[model samples]
Target: MPDFLTLANHCANPRQGTQPNGLPYYDGQGTLTEEMRWLRSFIDEGYLWYKEVPANLNMADYKTVLDYFAVLKTPLITASGQPKDRFHFTYPSEVWEAMSGAGVTLGYGITWSRSTGATPRVYVVTMVEPDSPASKAGVLRGDTLVSVDGADATTSTALAALSPTAAGQTHAFALKRGESTQTFSLTSQKVTEAAVQNTRVISTSTGAVGYLQFNDHNAIAERQLLDAFTTLKAANVSDLVLDMRYNGGGYLLVASELAYMIAGPAATDGKVFERLQLNDKRPPQAPQMFRTVSYGLAPTSLKAGVTLPYLGLKRVTVLTTAGTCSASESVINSLRGIDVEVNLIGGETCGKPYAFVPQENCGTTYFAIQMQGANNKGFGDYADGFQATCKADDDLDHALGDSSERLLATALSYRANGVCPATPLRARSSSSTGPLQLLRPVGKEIALRPR
Candidate 1:
């Protein structure tokens, strides 16, 4: 690895020319102060909002520098000055390597969301990865977590126990299923998430509806989606319902490929799936077209070299919630750009139109908002997020992909009648319902991992 100055200079946007203040950038043996000076200079020169920042700010340590830099970056702020940059953060190299490489983490393999309540009492299971300890322990989506190790599951201690930092840790869980409660003792392990959770062909009165629960857009998801579409196509399904309520987004290529699969070659041929806009200092990027091939985990690798399977559907129903974001929104945006009908159900998506390329400096990987994605029509400013066509609650009482699930059922109802459900499942307010805790930790959506 190069020195911090060299590494910073190499990729920092608006590369530093002579200092604007005409001060010597740094001249020392890389002391703490010198490093801070180098970082300050880098940010002062390259930050999108450098001019708006105060010239003198306290920088006592590395963490302070990061905090200060975060405050100075202006691109993250909305036009009215609200902070809109949740995607900007830094991670240690090892953590970044694990997340970007395999999407595995030390936990029990359950992605959960808290139910709105005053006192956190139930954690609703949103996704369960295949072959994980939680899955092997019979944990299913919609299961309500009541307790952990005899303590209220919503308590900080129980939540901490649920996500053990070390492998081989054991935790007992009490889950509520309908009227019955089940208990399971699960041992924490390294869990690799399966991006494609569930796929099936539902026999509907209208026709066969392909139901796919797409959780993430990781590299493995590229192949899993291809296989799922191949199965759907063989089943001769007429309509598709894509479940992305809990998906927080991943690679842009996977997003593009998914759009390609939903809209076949004829519909997507020579179309711009997504166009990336960099900062004013950088040159414009070429549009990312619908892909027909799957790439390896090494994001740039084409070693797998398999042609993507297509569904060639005219319309798709996408289930969404606040968790749906980034590349996930891209799928909805790009498809709509090309005139494909996308009917959204559930809550509004997490508004995120920006992406980042991980840049390493010293031992920390920085994920800064570097580019904005737009559709063919050049509409991309969705910072407030896309609203659902048919408003529906994420029914925690029913399993995802189940015919009776609130969001899925609403979508099915809309398909049959072309009207939104009048009285969708209503969500309980936090005061009325006990506080529900989110057990699983959320990970970053690294658009492109450095190989």
Candidate 2:
């Protein structure tokens, strides 16, 4: 590191004078947000090197930044700019009504708790899309989520637990419908999950080519992907189109598994996956520990059912945006290391290269942040996000009515220039965009199994 005083003096010189505040701020004060203050202090103290910044300085944590500024970006707003929902969060209550009436697909809907309604005094199923996972799972409109993964459902604890983790596990659910109780089991497979709203299809293409639209790298993602790929292979699908736009990310290993599936045996080429800068207090965990982290399918032999050398499918095109963070970025970062051409689009990514290993100190779960020294591609040094090879309309909501503008179209165009053929299709927007918005791929509706 360079001398801070000398650096500050050099920066303050007439030719390269310091600016007012160039860094993000945190700490919730009306004035003098802590991040900005520290940055200013660093400049004033002549700290020139990047290493001098505090380890806790997370400019990439949007929630922390938003809280520091006392801002809320997801509030529901009407055309007239009036707040639509009293609580700032609102959903379609009609979907709940339809589901309560035993309807199958409720289209797109939202839900909430009510204490006085017909199935009142509990956390009732307030909404359900007609063919969503909740709907397919037979979660009726008035059904009460009693417990999820052993946690009180009303607290959203069980719902949050639905976040994907490594393979070999299951998510348990207990529900109450009328006077009877039932349970459901969500087996995490390697296939991509239904997006947030369980609407859009992330994978769809003509011929041997397959498309996969994934949102998060959750525990079940690996198994879900494996099954999806196997299904695609059985269907004679060869080429692959992976749509990963606005994928804020979930688990890390899920990303690794996806990478290996696309790269096949070629992923063995050592490369970077983004460096993990650790907090001095933490250290790496032993590779042999083999701790059971989440409830989902356990990792199995990638060589299952294969006699010949398993060469995974060739390269893939990864959709990207500023909203893509954590494990999503890790996928792009790692894949690019193995000489895989990651067709980047949209704005700069949410730089979250540090790997968070879950740990428990006193009953409280803490995420011990560390960085990948290297990925399977052996390209871990590249950080601060990869620059986009091309750009697209990241503001999908604004482009919904604009027929000529689409990020997926741009991605497909680029795909055609490579080994994949151009297909006349539209990519899904996001998982949370609703099921009616989901691109229908494969799968059939089955009766909800009782837990």
Candidate 3:
């Protein structure tokens, strides 16, 4: 096989210049078939489950490059009966750059919760980014989506309308929250995300408990976390509830920093937070150590040499769901590795200890399981995901960070007492609803991150 670079940069629509990330494009003599071959060889060499990928998948049988790439992943199943390699996919390189960098995207800025594999689908807004189109329209959490563009929300046509298109494309949405129904003609546009939100000190009888909704692990997250930690430090909060139910993960280092900030130097100063283990054919990797100081990495973060504020707590409560993935899972596992108890609430995390550095070739960025992660103790076998300590529905009726919210309240109660409630909360439903549903993000299915 030829070197992968020899077959790269053969875009059908070859870019005219460099991208916003300053990646330069070059001309290539490569063809579509050569590009496909490059991918086949790349996967054979780099994928963690390289041996499980079918040996007989002839590239000629596929029509499009995407179709060929789709069938290249392992067909193996996990012990949990789920597909072992569900996180394989690709993205337009530019789109990934914006998201991994500043957490910006084109959308209504509403993270919705949809009932998976349930008939007569029900979708609810779990979060609305402040100042975005969804928030400007006064859309709130707990608002059940009834219709899109006058069609039933469950229908394929209506659901397609909600897919991201371009800025200024408008769609009508009918939603019901409790007894009141509201409709919105919302437009899609570039929405800069607030990676961390709803940060506040919840004054409990036990002490000041700090809580913050962390939605992404992008570059901007570093600064926001520093600011949030600073606030929590000033309040001297005794406990912390990190809400990561919708975070799909980003940079691995950002996750390590979060773990350090939670556990502090006493627990993590000399320990590894997470170690990336590549496939058998690859070289050994250096473990990702717990970061102690801030580099002011984000475009708008504090200047270099600023010390990070840590909670120095031995225990932390994390709010989670299946939408909590990759780097988010790393934070939980790493904290637990150092014997810093992570009491989880909500649902189990999306089981994915694997990560891959995005590789851009021919204008597309590819994601594959190149490495699996382990915590300090070198244990990384939670494929089915970390189970919740207290099973509580995400209470959308009360805004996130509110003390009455189910997940936060449960965390508070669990900390007060070392046990879960007798009966856990479930998503509220009327007789008209289907099986009990849990809050899951309507955004990307898996994490987009590096290890």
Candidate 4:
């Protein structure tokens, strides 16, 4: 007899269907009957596991077990939330990672049909890029995803199962827009945004400094960072003031690149970038490291080395808030490991350190276990949430004036005279185009936000 999981895997990845139903029919050869019995047992075990879930396990652990079994049997459903059990599991974390990694804009907005009278739905939009595959496939805003391939994914699990590999995989999406339901096929492609997001820059009021911000890191974060550096160097900006107040973490490599850039290229000669510790608390595989090239010690080259590079930052003043999370915190914690000046300000950050990767089981999508420990400087679990070194001291309604104004002002003071000022920087402009102007000038309390 085949192993339980082996049979399950075979069931999930069956041979070509002989007829209308996608399932393989039972011949008297006994293979089909035995497979069916194994599948039944597998389902029964999963039910038992779900029912026997330990009370002591945290939500994350509980979720992991539930997810492991879901891969064995993915349930499919139709557009009206109909049960379409032809598919496998749904909501496998890997699907979420792959979709987001492919540069899709994921948000939790209420998706409703007029007939359903507003049941909560997760709204996914394929925002167009200059020349991406999604744009090429004619996917646009207001287009609702109904299913991937022939699998019905009307629920969160179904949605997660649509994770496509790479940017070039062909994805068939059944969608709804306005009042019409339709289907379209498109090759997954990376979206390139003209605006920069999660990039690092340095301007000098007295000396070199840091200035970084990002619109999104899903696609071209690495490119944006390179561009920002080139522009800042040309403009003779010094030091650095990283602006990640709006960044939601995306590709892990991009975050690592940012860390390498800020750390320079010399300090990271075969050093750890960060570690991923599973719950078992075993020492993570050797910390992933990156080398730097050009500038500082090696040569005054803006280009970085293929291997380890510099990892030195005199002082880092990270401007953050609640929007900061995951890869964002990874970059921050990595920098802190080498003793970069991390003046955390603005607000608290969302704590998520587990890195995720996708693995498919017979089109029943799932995530591979790929997270690490939080010993980035032995400063304890950075996931406990890093509080602002300078917490805001004003009311919530006055958020703009209180949090940002105060944070930026203190950062400027520290850079200018190595100490915070008694008063906060006043606001100047609030125009969407003028982000830098929103904060007071780097060295002085000159309100820059447009009125």
Candidate 5:
């Protein structure tokens, strides 16, 4: 297998730079001289921030290489100039395969958000995968986890550790609901997450409102979304509320297809959904076009397709949060680009106009930011995130997709009154306008899964 240095040189964006200097021709190991030379050559050819790299940094140390890469992030000037590069990271190949290929993860099947306030922290359930351990154990969105295996669930580290890595492992959870605390014991299992959590037609005085709690943008989501829209269309729904509160995003193709479904053939017949801009070193690729429904994941296999059931909607209400990112943001941006109204409810989106094509090296998958995505008008610099049109709390106290949920209710209120409800002073103080935090265990990367 090629060493890390060689793989880094071949795959890193920019693909050319200065070499690092160091000692150690042979640190008690054979042929240190050749290894050091190769390291210098790799750095010179592939380091994106070669000019900023310290000349005296140890060239042969893998840690040194990673440390250098960490600091050499290109600052995105549009995002309030915050020196953040959270998009770059590496994970084990097995993790990448499970998450990208199967949408599987070892846990109790609950996605959560941690509160940043005082001690004895609160960990609230954001979404629960259907039929997963968490759901089976009676977990619901907005359930405040008071304790996890007897430990307080306030800290992020504590909350993360609650996710079991091994199957059949049991953990105790004490959740607070309606001023009462209840305990449930759940055994961990390999959860295959369903992208579409819940879909129903809500009848109100105005008309039928299609409510879809879309959790992830994985490949299976393509079929799930098609089915959801098919039902909605059959019901003759007039409006849509796409709940993407806990969706961190997955495939761009799915995003495009969704935009096409909402806007329909008339608005998207020949429209550009998103445009990708590559590094100056590579040739620019064609813009991604809005696509109709297809049976398979690949574009060429659309022969078995039916006419996509589009809402033909000129406007849509999207439920968002800090967890709404990447492909999720893409859908919002693309729709707005084509003159479609996107009424954002809840918190600001996690500003990530950038994306990556996962590259494997030394049995690890590296998600390096390589491209920027813009809409038809070429306005894709939302590193500071898209602010909400109507601010509302997540209202973990109520179930998602419920008519009474704060965010959902706010959207419905806007639909009826054509005005944003006054954001309560308390809700505004706890909104997601603060600095973005990494919501999921894995870093964000938008790519097509292996078919």
Candidate 6:
């Protein structure tokens, strides 16, 4: 393969100016076909399973660049019989940048979870964004979607038609919430999703336990986390129930900061939060340390260099599910690395110890696995996902952060008595933010569950 670096930024319709980083685009004479070759070279060199990718496919057989990318992934399967890599894909560079950088998106802010088998598949409201139109329309979490625009939206095909694209796009949703049925009109708009929600100090029998539903590790999450930790710290909480059930994941830096906040200086002072190992061809990169201070990422009031607060707790309870992934798992893994007891409560995580450096060429940004990560303890082989210590059902009946909610309640129970529940919950539905949909799709990260 030739030097793919030489063909970098040589766009078909080149931008004539500098990027936001003040770096000029290395735009040279190029075509779509040339861009594919550049991507091929990059994958051949950097992809984590570079040797596993089929090398015999002709590039001319692909119609679009994205089509080519879809087939360029490793076809290996995990021990659990799941696809080895479902998280490989590309998107418009602009969309990825906006979402990961600022948690920005154009939508009604209703996160969905689908169940199948019957003709009329059930679509449940897994989560609703704070202050979003769906929230304003009184769309509660766990509401079963009955219809879309007065039409039955039970089939998978019908679900595909309910895409929220442009702002001002209006749609009516008929939902079943318990015994009652309600319909609401919602206009799609630009939604700036918040990372932390329902943060509060719960007075448990054991002690004041802090509960916070962390949805993603986007940039906006930095300040929100600081605020939540500050609140929990000020309240003198003895334990924490970090709800990451719906969280996919995002920025590694945010995860490091959060780990430090939970375990504090005594445990995290010199500990590595995540150690990234690139492909065998590349030299080993430096490990990410637990950050005690903020980097002051944008869309927030938190300034850089402020010493972050710490809970200094020896044990932390993390609420998990199949949707919990990437950096979220990093938090669980790193906390365990420092001997900080991380009691998990839900289903297994979305197991992704792998990550990639997003590379943009022409108009689309591509994500291909380039690294496998381990904690300071050097144990990172949970690709099948981290299983729960106490298996709990995702309760749609109770509001999140409510002490009675299944996951949160179970966590509180375990703290009171050091044991899991007698019975495991068989959930009726699970989160359905498949490989194709995720929040913060730009970076080497993920989310439900959102975006």
Clash totals for all candidate models = 4, 53, 0, 52, 2, 2
Ten-residue region with minimum lDDT total, candidate 1: 9-18
Candidate 5, 1-451: lDDT as tens digits: 3343543423222212321223222111224333434444433433333343456655445443344444444444334656545576667656776776567888888877766654444567767888888888888876767887777776554565676668898878899876899998988888898878679999999899999998777756777788899999999999999998777778887888898999898888778888987654457788888878664552332333656679999999999888888889999999999999999998898887876666553334556566688997798988778999988767766677889888899999999998987643133215443222334675433533222
Compute the lDDT for candidate 5: 0.71
Cα distance off (Å), candidate 5, residue 392 = 0.5
Tens-digit lDDT track of model 4 for 59-96: 23323333434443324444646432221323433343
Candidate 3 has a TM-score of 0.94
What tens-digit string does per-residue lDDT give for candidate 1 at 303-351? 4567888889889999988778888999999999999999999878878
- Quantify all predictions' global Cα lDDT against the true fold: 0.74, 0.42, 0.81, 0.46, 0.71, 0.81
Report the Cα RMSD per candidate.
6.8, 17.8, 2.3, 14.3, 7.4, 3.7
Candidate 6 lDDT tens digits, 62-149: 9877888888888988777888987887878777878777888877888776664444456778778889999999999888888887
**How would you encode candidate 2's per-residue C-alpha lDDT over 1-451 as one tens digit per residue?**
4232222222111222222234322112222233333333332232112233334543445333223222222234556465322111111222221221122221222232333323212444433444444556665544555787777764656655443443344666676865898886644433322432221223335334455556545434545566666565565554555656546565555565566656655454443333343334346433211011222323342323322222255566565654566667766766666666667755466455545433211111222222343544445553455666665534332221122335555655666564222432222322223211112100110000001
- RMSD of candidate 2 to true structure, Å: 17.8
Which residue pairs does candidate 6 place in steric collision? 248-447, 249-446
Q: Give the TM-score of candidate 6.
A: 0.92
Weakest lDDT window of 10 consecutive positions for candidate 3: 434-443
Model 4: residues >4 Å from true position, as ranges? 1-99, 106-195, 198-204, 208-210, 215-219, 234-236, 279-284, 291-312, 362-370, 393-410, 417-451
Q: After superposition, how far is residue 137 of candidate 1 from its true place, in Å?
A: 2.2
**Angstrom error at residue 50, model 4:** 13
Q: TM-score of the candidate numbered 4?
A: 0.51
The alpha-carbon lDDT assigned to residue 141 of candidate 5 equals: 73
Candidate 6 weakest ten by summed lDDT = 433-442
lDDT of 1: 0.74
* Index of the highest-lDDT prediction: 3
